[model samples]
Target chain A: MKMLRNLLCSAALASLTATGAMADGHGWSLKKAAAPYAGTTVDVVFLLRPGYEAIEAMLPAFEEETGININIIKHPYENALGEQVRDFVAGGDLDIALIDLVWIGNFAENDWILPLADVQAKYPDAVDPKLDMDDFFPLVLNAFGGWNDTVYGLPFDNYSGLMFYNRCMLEEAGFDGPPATWQELKDVYGPALTKNGKYAFALQSKRNETQSADSFARVLWPFGGSFLDANFKSNLNSAESQAGLKFRQDLMQYMPDGIVAFDHAETVNGFSQGDIAIITEWSAFYSSVVSPDTSKVADCVEIAPEPMGPAGRKPALGGFSLAVASQADEAEQAAAYLFIQWATSKANAREYLERGGVPARQSVYEGDDLEAFKFVPALVESWQDGVPEFRPRFAEWPEITEIVQEWGTKMMLGDVTTEEGATEIGTRMESVLEEAGYYSGEKPLAQ
Target chain B: MRGQVSRKTIFAFVGPAVIGLAAVGIAPLIYAVWTSLHFYNLTKLKKVKFIGFENYSTVLTDEVFWQAMGRTFFLLVTALPLQIILGMSIALVLHQPGLTLIKTLCRLSLVLPMATTYAVVGLLGQVMFNQKFGVMNQLLGGADINWIGDPENAFAMIVFWDVWQWTPFVALVLLAGLTMVPGEVEEAARLETKSKWTVLRYVQMPFLLPGLVAVLILRTADTLKLFDMVFTLTRGGPGSSTEFISLMIQRVGFRGFDQGLASAQAIILLIITIILAQIYIRVFYKEV
Candidate 1:
């Protein structure tokens, strides 16, 4: 038995040698002698979004076609991108990666991603021609994937902040429809809707990326404020912006106090359980909110545009992007690009949307299948009007989020004055920018 | 003595395990230390340049780091005493007679929170404390109170969560100590006509000293590193009131993308933990 096993191993080794030689001879370059990697299984790190199972299930067909085995490693959205960045810097072996839109600037700045231009040039036909860069809603893709005029990543799943409310609750509160403006939301609907055991709103106030994206950023643009001036100095502390922050804090008085502890799930649960009247949440959560099994308020929930601030209505854009690893081998890189192309193709996006995924493309929003889905029209309109704050995209976003969460939550709790919070955020943000070389000691970015 | 084994045999037994230890432990420790000394810029594409004590100084001086530290300590203060008191009360209850079924049920109930995943626990806590239909508010007729939105309520919820999950762990330790008390000693105290309070103060507590030490040591370390409960609960919210050290480290390391600074902050936390452990050990082992 030992002799037979040895003989089989020798035969397998011979085949492996032959394949390695063949790979080197057939245009494969490597620092060491090349192996074809045809049968070698590699893990493709995927962030497990709502509709990702179908994309993962489709991978077997690609594996069969390519003659290479694929393994899927799923991670939460934030951790996956954070791990990808660490892996790239440490030269760790990661074949494929999923990243968020706001992470593009930092990824691009550090050259952590492989530029797809080379892959596109090589596989024009393999790449989806229908991607039609022009077809994507300008703000969605522009905020996430575009950096220094280069398209760094492909949009995977994209969504904008939209106001989701209990239509029944609104009607019960003596309103026939959702509030149209910030004043109406605060003065009229918020007070009227707030009653014995229910809150008027369930907006996220807990400091994190979600708070920055869905709540704070969405309110800022509507109030005619931006994170930075044209020169990239911190501009979130303006009086108009403070008004927006204060308005959100005041609104919390009528909402659930546990909002300080609430992230996306708590807020969604609050609304879906018919505990709160309204929630300004991501479009991606639409299907779940309206699904009967998951939500008691499903039929009662209706989508509406984000409320207008003093200046105008501006909704925050939230989305994901696909970027290939710089360190992935030739075959892996080719596989990644192919996977991205297929995963984000027009057909795939439509399929994803039909399965309740939010698509980045404008055309997908108009699809008959999507229109049939509940709240699709409102979601589409919100995407069209999305005011993408772009997360400031500095490497310091995590720290920036901390600053925002600390002060934002404090303001909501009435622990800090808006001016105090805003001034502190602006000061800290300036120092971060200065350290990042966006500003000099002699003159701050704004100065 | 059989201690003098063959040198070759000794090496044969220890070599692979030592190599494994170094591979898993020493390598990362060294790497973390090395990384902690450098700028470790993520956006700049530049190799990590050694910045000596710069990152450490920055972390020490950074206002946010101090704020997170304060918040972390605040959570500890809110959680620790409540956890100890509740745990002792439960432990005392479990010591009663003819309560076997009740004791078993109580044990099972107390263990449930620890058994639950933090995300679920956090979400459940939020739901219970929800200003509207939350069971906690509804039970208290606090239908209008927002338990997580306001700073005070947010802090209260975090404390409630910390106590809920951990009080049982403390109770279990104290209960174990309660069971170790000698029947004869208790009987002697009873025969001496000792007051209930005196018996508890002198006999019961002194015997539970080791157990109390064990609970305090574990709780202190656990409370110091409290992350998921807060992260899942308040996410260090209605601003920085709920922010703690672990979340702060994550914010700095992953979001800020400044490994050196994060590492520096982490080292400070490590030092604090070590100092606290030392203090605990000294007090525990002190000759009274």
Candidate 2:
């Protein structure tokens, strides 16, 4: 146990050194700051996403250095945002919350989070002034954390959706490549898979964030349709949207019958169990799917571009952000900002990505070490151009989520016409938007 | 002075209990009532302002709410009678005294289901009734029956789940009544050459009145608030075909974050349950 402990420590030290070197080369490193907020124990809430398993492994080091005991409250992926929102609303003591990026609008608008500008002002070297708005993926950084032209949160672990396919299966089916267009997808590859058999394509259809992120909105974007029109009116009932929905329903023929109820675990298990030949999901699962221990087809796996639609190949951005709660005590508030800066720093992000985290930094994406990411190229392309139909980030998102989930499930189940479902959804979405004051005296989108 | 002392002692003993109930239960009940009279959205939980009777009006008008209530009523009406009849039959069979091993096995089997957790029972029920990969489908040679997916079939499956889990409880209740039926009365009726049906009708059932009432009252309250099995199995899906009122309340309050509407629905449901309880007590204990 002693030798094992030393080896583990050495490994951690080596990774830390490598990250520090990377940061130094990039001119993003700094000397340690004066111990302000010393001896303060702050409660930091972390949503239990996969990459954070490494951070959790390394938390004792942070605690040892800072003398601040971090209390990690890991919520299930499904209820994490809801729980954070509830905590903030109830005036519960949450020093920091790792909120989903899409949920930032609601958090900021409701004044549930403290502005981080002042905190960022104090720690110049710890959080470089030039680096504050530079070297990061501008779209992701600005969209999620910046509200009303002010930064209120920081991007943590970020992901762009991508496609995975069984290379062996494709090769055996008289193809040496992946489909590049929607028509080609339907024509060249549609008939190669079976439904009842274990070796089928799988897609998420569960009624949650994954559904909204990966399945529904991803499909909608490629069809030149969106959940909301330019004027923020619901446009779900439009012809373009219906066409996209119909495409997904048609694709269900080659997928598992249990797709309607499948979540991330089910989809991952299906692929690992050799039950699926293809998967299109969040890029975070790429490493696990290609890891030999976790997947049987690991050796035979290959990352492919997202299948093209009428509009283009656009995938949704799926990730989380860091925020300080408005209700935190002053000391706790300072600690929370420090933690966010430390957590998202260039050095930390590199170490994080090496352990399979997808960083929000453009430098990380462009780095040499990321070549092993396998899908990094596609992930970057998608992230840069993706139309993030972020779950209508408003106070009424839960209600709007239900509208999408219930109708999305119906569309998947073939229980309703896409046009009909979209019409109903549009009506409900309009009402929610109107009630939330997002919709003005504009004509509703075409049904 | 004696009366005063007695009153003082009673108040002293009961004070804690009264305070405990008020603090734990009655306060929440009162708060729920107060909230029910307003528009309590969780997002605006802190800023919740009074808007009397609006939530109630909304509850009465929501299509999904009515659907949930309808499904709940159907479950209560269908499951209650069937549960009692089946429970009484099993109880009667167990009351017989001949084969010790068989009797013990039967009693054990009846108790085993009740001992299992409701969530586990719901899951087991789903597995049994699963369309693609279920034992029921396999037994029927994979005939593609949508047991838990179709509206009519899902309702029947939920009712079946309820009966399977709780019929044993009903049987246990009736078994107590069966044990208490006087042997002399039964023997006397036998000696008089009364038919088996006649003896059962005249002696057994009348003696089991209180037990039967107990089963009804317990099952009525339980079936009215059925949430777990239905929630786990169907999730009140296929367009809310099997939604129960409890599930609706949870959705409105927790999922929808519309606390006032949920509270209003709860208040209405409470009044109904109370009225039903009083009526059942009056009908069952008239002689007593």
Candidate 3:
């Protein structure tokens, strides 16, 4: 029944995409529109991740369609923001700014990336009227790129956190299915599964962005918590927030011994090595989890939407956007914009998904091979509703995130009580926001 | 001609070195001092302005800054003594007569850890010290030590790795200093004082003092500025338990883009390093 439904959906999606593809020729299809900037070189920094590698796989066609050379510079996820920031400050040769969702405010406020409207006006030929910005998943599009009702970037490589679990491991532990809720995972599966020196789950709680995004902020929303209230005051001290954190503290027992130091790589490797049964990881890691080379139990891995919390399911949201660099000259900017439009276009979403790229286009999800990639259904659902400001996409968030990373890790390590940690974070976070002029109205609220 | 010093000749000989020093050292120092006084956040470049020692004031009162200082002090005190003692013991054994081949072999062995890069040593620490899968746990018959996750263990692992990597260099330095001792002076001391301890204290201590001072100065600077190893190893983590002054400053300046605050913190660190170095020199002189 599922296969038949997918087949029918694929057919309907094909016609919709065909209609969208044909409409592309009238506005800014790469083959014709990119002709003027054919020889131009578009320099962009790409992180060494599955999504970026997937994009790289689909790049040859992009290059062929438009005679543009993408001068790809690779950086690790931890360092890419710094590298891009330095390049922007120095007026270096990055034509396209690869922006982490958290960095959108920083880059946009700094006027480092050309706003979508500004870029369209500046480079008319590169503007895709038929590109249909509305086609982008509203949550992802806004979160990854939007700033103060202005879109600065198009959602490109995206992530929605999902539960990747080993079905075999769960079955062996005498549980027939994955946990349906966070509470269930702790109260039921955790005790049943975490035996024989193996862990039931792992949270990538390493200090840095991982601790902030993957571990710390991940819990808040589902438990009816958030970093800041509607008035922009620190919301971490609320009982709801503390409950979420306290729950995480309790869940730590089922995790690996040194999990407080584990990052996404470590957690994924743990799942791969059969050391852990389940992990709530980004959907972008689907390729790695399924690959025979990286995973020993590749065949047994199953992915589902992150389990429910007291309130509901709100999973981790993280990814980057691509925008034309403000530093780029008109020609390079046009080429960069052209590339962004082409790569993220609805016409190209199918190949992108097939290769490995996690496209944010709503129309693309219904296309073929939805079942093959087990994470996509979970991804679509998780991404259906998301916290756009999961980590608080404000210019001051970088500084505040450091505070969160510090206190969040301390909380996990038992250095500070959950309430104490939350209180500290709230105090420090308010200080940062106050400095950034959030309280004084020097700067308005950022998403 | 031999006694007379020509100014032009002196300038010609010293000009390149002076120019190089001024360009690399003096210029950056001036810039840092200037930056330290301002509200110079890199992200808010347009808003950067002269705030007049406000950054310094912030640094002085900052709790995190002091915590980092405390951690740095702990690491330095923990690692340096171990390195010095181990190096001294290894150096003394190597200094014994008729152990030329042993000395050569020991020196060769010393190069291995020193030659490995700081970042790689940090990575090696992770591979070895990992609780579940690391070699250290396996070797210890499944000892469940959260070497990187636990606060105290993480710091201790750093100290352990620090001693492992740097002890070799310390031993080599002391051995070279020991070699500078005259063979006859050593033999005479040994013969006169039946106690090896007395001979080492009175005779060998004099020569080793210079080397020891050098080690103290170098290691003081090295430990204070330690970044890469900790960055790759624990990242000042298990909740900033191992974050040193240098790591904190880098995050402030580079990651947080608060250049002014970082500069102010750096200047403070510089003063602290100078004070520590002075104390070392004065204490060593008193001992001598």
Candidate 4:
């Protein structure tokens, strides 16, 4: 009976797609204009995530309607960028790729991924008119998609860093809510919450981009510090940055002993295992935190907007965008663009959200389904207030990230003073940028 | 005459190996040297151009590269001698002419560490050497020691982990070498010498020298290129204290996307390894 129903649905979708009319039954459909490219196969490579798994589950429906075979390739998060870069370098046939926002400048400047404007210009009907570009959060749309006035990708997955706290632990510590500011967190909540083998906090400080950009920037921005000054000079050694580093060092006393080596896995697992009281983590971890199999504090965990920093509240923004590959042939590019459009459209956004995907659509956040998840309000608030450029999003970010990770980690471990670390990072970053032709005074900071 | 090979026979025996070596080893080395002379970056493919030893000059002057070289040398110097002592001691104990069951059990246990992959050992070290909840601290009556959090302790833990994983292989090799030492020669030396130490010093030490040299050469080469253990264990932390030369090359190549610099660093590492191997051959394997 299910097979017959599916066949009927597929046949109806095919007819609707062929007739150049919108399919209204399921409230979502591939553009009828995409019929010309029906038989094209688009190969997409992305990092494995729960949201991607949801998209994989919806592949059959998409395939049946569009008559396009979707070949999904997943790589581990750590190696995904390298794999994509290598693929682009070799001109391998990849139709679509999930690109990290930090990689936008690199991919765009190098012309690795097709500019969406060019795709739209070449194929007039590539993007559906009904696909409301205004529905996505402006911050996310600009951060993930727009690069130097050109849209390179569509924002697919969105993340905002939030403080996930153990409600039970906080209650036991005589607090009704999570800390509102960094000072309260350090002076009051951290000490009170730490007890009986449970640490007050877990941080993602492992010596990588996570430590330098995601975890460290969460504090740096709140302390009113930026990676670069207004003139594109390294400002890491500023007083605000030093104070933030010192605060992080002091907070270590209430954390796990080897907190310096903790990464996303350790931080998330520590919280899940009830060994950590609070963690500032990406909103995408909502599914894992609420899952019964993975989390011990599923019932007691609560999400809150990032604690106030000295400068103000600035949440860490981390996520990826789905972009069409320039190396792909014309038909594949159109097919990929259609897929990106439909996947991020309002009609499909709610469904994607229900299936553990975090959509960037603002309408979805304002919908009735907002009441379904406990973290939605806080997550939405973070999205509205977060600073996407807390870490520089440029082609040379990967190199700069290494310098930050090296010196920032040293400062965190007390092996180097904050001033020394900042100086070293600034000097090394200047050299790296100079070698890349940034300081020549002729070229802009990014090509 | 029977053992002497014709040209075709020689080709039959060595042709596949020669092809394999050219494809896997020689090709990559040549390509690395070629790349080292250019300003090639994977991210900036369009900007690739030949720059003539600029990358080599950059590497030679880079302080991080020199620090990494110093750390690699420190690790090699510290771990090799300790590994040799531990291996020889175990080999001597296992070669004793009694307690067959104990010998069998010891031999089986010796293979255990050698059997496990170094990557797995590195990961296990992370859990076991964790400062807070690790089994090592738990076993030490909950004493607080920052094994991977402190720069010194992290470096020590890396050395200790390498020693633990490789000492067994060294022991097994030395045990095989010890067996090849004839019993009659040792007994004759024992009869002629006034002390057991004198017999071992004269008879057994000479027999073990060639195998010792081989083990030293292999371990030195392996340790020089050590990456997986460091990558999985501490990621060259805290603050690059445990960063090995290979890790630096990887960071420069993959993360920094500077293929030219990485290739230059790799070529320098290769030259250093060759020089060390020659020294070992000259000093220990004079017969060769």
Give the best candidate by TM-score.
3
Report, in order, each candidate's fnat.
0.85, 0.11, 0.74, 0.85
Q: Write the per-residue lDDT of candidate 1 for residues A1-447, one digit (tens) a residue.
A: 332243334323323443544544454222111134355455567766665665675667656655556677788765776777778888877866566766776677677776555555543333443345555565665566555545657677777778898999888767898888887888998888888778898777556776677667766788878777777766777877877877777777677755665778778887988989988887788878988988998889888878877787777677877767677876777666666756666666677776777777777766566545666776677766665454666555656776666666666656778788778778887776776666664323321
For candidate 1, the per-residue lDDT at A108 reads 70
How far off is residue A199 in model 1, in Å? 4.3
Residue B178, candidate 3: C-alpha displacement in angstroms: 1.1
Top-scoring candidate (DockQ): 4
Please give the DockQ score of every candidate, comma-separated: 0.52, 0.36, 0.73, 0.73
Report the lDDT tens digits of candidate 3 across residue range B73-143: 88888999999999999998998878688778878999999999999999999899988779998888888
Candidate lDDT (C-alpha), each: 0.71, 0.73, 0.87, 0.82
> Tens-digit lDDT track for model 1 on B1-288?
567798889889999999999999889777777878998856445757998998889989988789888887888877888888889999988987787898899888988988988778887876787665689978886567777766677778888888888899989988888887788887798788758777777677877778887777788778777888777776666566667888888777776677787888888888898888788777864321
Between candidates 1 and 3, the one scoring higher on TM-score is 3
lDDT per residue (tens digit) for residues B1-288 in model 2: 666678778889999899999999999999999999987887766557899898889888977677777778888889988988899889888888788899888888988889988878778877888766788889988777777656677788888888988999999888888788899987898788758778777777777888887777778788778887777776666445666899779777877777888899999888888888888888875331
All candidates' TM-scores? 0.81, 0.87, 0.94, 0.91
TM of chain B vs. native, candidate 3 = 0.96
**Isolated chain B TM-score per model:** 0.90, 0.90, 0.96, 0.95
Candidate 3, residues A292-410, lDDT tens digits: the string is: 99999899999989989987998899998999899999889889988998888888888888777899999988767577878888898988767777888888877888889999998
Off by over 4 Å in 4: A1-41, B1-15, B98-109, B131-133, B141-144, B286-288
**Which scores greater on TM-score, model 1 or model 4?**
4
Model 1 Cα interface RMS deviation (Å): 2.7
